[model samples]
Target chain A: MAFFILVIAALLVSVFFNSLGAVSLYRFPDVYTRLHGATKCTTFGTIFIAVAVVLYAVGRLLESGENRFWVLIIHTLVAMMVLLVTNATGAHAIARASHRSGLAPAKAVVDRLEESCSRGGASQ
Target chain B: MFIFFASFLMYLLLVWSGSGIPMIEVVIGLLMATVVTFAYKTWHPEKRLSKRGLDPRRWFGFVAYLFGPFALGLAKANIDVAKRVITGKIRPGIVKVTPALKSDVARTLLADSITLTPGTLTVDIDDAGAFYIHWLYVEDENPSEEQLYGNFAHWARRLAE
Candidate 1:
């Protein structure tokens, strides 16, 4: 009963955050802020989903004493790690490319990147 | 050496069944690990992964950070972003943070950590170690490492440096 409750709660959290991620794309002003919303929220949401799946796998492993469920847990973890790394790196790439192509943030109070670009760009 | 052993162990662990493992699987695992190690070395010739990560203490620290501060910050970030998404109150801007990290591994770790947690998206890292971040709520033009990413800089230094 407790295991099912935990799994349900995890799924609920995952759905809420994922829906928020979709909403954020329309809510934010520019690509950067939109990236902030879409990337972080989805990444976090997927993490919860992975957790729930892992929990399910664990329960199966314990109930049946199956070695296959162990593999299921491992595969889930590997998928989660790949998603986490790729999500963050992809966000960075999009943000950098947008900034490089002269797409500035909207309604900004400060842009040190633009400031640095104006001042002959920052060098090592 | 580190890559080879780590990959070998991982491959064996995945291939392991409840019964005794077969010799063929062990041979295949060795071959795969060797190929991966050589490919990694050729791709990043300049980066000789330091022995620092090999220290067991660092691994323990990293695991603790993952479940402790990293997890907490991720929760906070999602809640904060969710609230802002609903209310439509965002003070967005690109600001700079200079975290004086020496190694590339540490810098990348910090950048990824910053991006995943909080209202910060790592836009770019300059030729120097300064990070240009798109903050949802820009409170400071010149924010410190703590302001931008809490103890992530310290954790990066501990785990990767």
Candidate 2:
């Protein structure tokens, strides 16, 4: 029963965050802001899903008094780690490409990149 | 180094408490993870730190944004997609939704998020971080790229605000 509750909570949390990421994609004033919200929320949501699985496996392990819990927990954790690294790196690449492609912040008062590029041109 | 050790120790304690793992095993596990992290850092020393310095306050704001208005927007999108799917109202076209994000990290996040969702698939990303989206249902009205991205950008800023 407790395991069921945990699983349900995990699902709900994951869905909630996924929804949040989608909404933020719309609300964010600029691409960078959208990226920040989507990446962090999705990462956290996926982590919760893994945690739920771990909880279920651990419960089973305790009930059976077996060593299978280690397998589930460790493997799930490794998977989570892979997700963390890949998602983050992917986000970085997208942001870099976006910046290079000339998308400006909708409400920027300062233009540091513009200044630097102009400075480089003048130097040449 | 101190911060990393402290975090590892905290993780060790948590795992040991929850999993009923032996302290020695927990320590070993934590050590292994730390070693892996160190190896990754060594392999990519130049990319270790973010060009924009980390700020905790901004991070918290970003989290709050995700948990609030962003969620609302996703809910709406979900409903919209469901409606389109059920009604068979999808035109299904690939359209470019260019975002104005300055960071590669941010653009990747946006793209992945779009891909993960049901109705939209990210087909291609250009060098400038512009995403080509294949919508399951494109309305006959043919929404402009700016119009399409406008919804996403609004919620994204709120989520990361």
Candidate 3:
């Protein structure tokens, strides 16, 4: 019963964040805002999904006492670690490339990078 | 040598329990790992694993950081971003942050952590090791170091520098 509840909760959380991310992509005005919504919401949602998988694997291991379940848990964990690291790196790369391609923040008043760059390229 | 051993161990783990695999396959995997490691070393002869980064104490600090500040910051940033999405109120801006960490790896880790947190995205790193981050809500035109890093820099220094 507890396992079921945990699984349900994780599913709900992932669905909520994923839907929110989709909505944000539609709602936001500019590229950066949309990127923030798309990247963060999906990453958070995927983490919850991975957590659910881990919890399920652990529950199975406890019930079955099988070595393969242990392997499943460890592999799931390694996949989660890879996902977390790669997601962050990929988002950073995209944001950096977008900014370098001259996409300005829509509502920003003070452009610090521009200010510094104009001042003898202090922001290389 | 370290890279070779680590890669071999990783290849063994990838075989995973070795229940059904033949002994010949294991030997082939070992040979492949060795070849890959040799190729990597030949391609990057100047790249040596830094002793400080390999310290056990630094590994402990990194584990602590993943559980402590990084986790807390991730949760907080997620909530903050969620609220901003709901309210449709954001004051986005790019700001420069100069962390005290001198090591390139430490600075890269800090930048990656900041980028992973929902409300901030690392946009650029200058030659002086300063970060320009795109913050979802810029509270200050000129944020202090504490505001920028919030104990992350300290952890990065401990773990990598």
Give the alpha-carbon lDDT of every model: 0.89, 0.59, 0.80
Q: In every candidate, how many clashes are there?
A: 0, 37, 0
Model no. 2, DockQ:
0.05
Question: Model 2 over residues B18-95: C-alpha lDDT tens digits?
Answer: 446776876676787688678767887776445233567666766665556445545445555535423434344445
Candidate 3's displacement at residue B51, Å, is 1.6
Query: In model 2 chain B, where is the ten-residue run with the lowest total lDDT?
Result: B84-93
Q: What is the lDDT of residue B135 in candidate 3?
A: 80
Docking class of 2: incorrect
Worst 10-residue lDDT window, candidate 3 chain A: A115-124
TM-score of 1: 0.94
In terms of TM-score, the best-performing candidate is: 1
For all the predictions, what are the DockQ values? 0.74, 0.05, 0.60
Interface quality of candidate 1 as DockQ: 0.74
Cα lDDT of model 1 by residue, B1-161, tens digit: 88999999989877876566899999999999999999999998888777767888988988898899988998999999999999999999989888889888899888888998889999888877888889999888888877888878888987887
True contacts kept of 3: 0.46
**TM-score, ranked from best to worst:** 1, 3, 2
Candidate 3 lDDT at B105 equals: 88
Q: Which stretches of candidate 2 lie over 4 Å from their true place?
A: A1-124, B1-14, B19-26, B51-53, B116-118, B140-146, B149-151, B154-161
TM values, all candidates: 0.94, 0.50, 0.93
Under CAPRI classification, how is model 3 graded?
medium
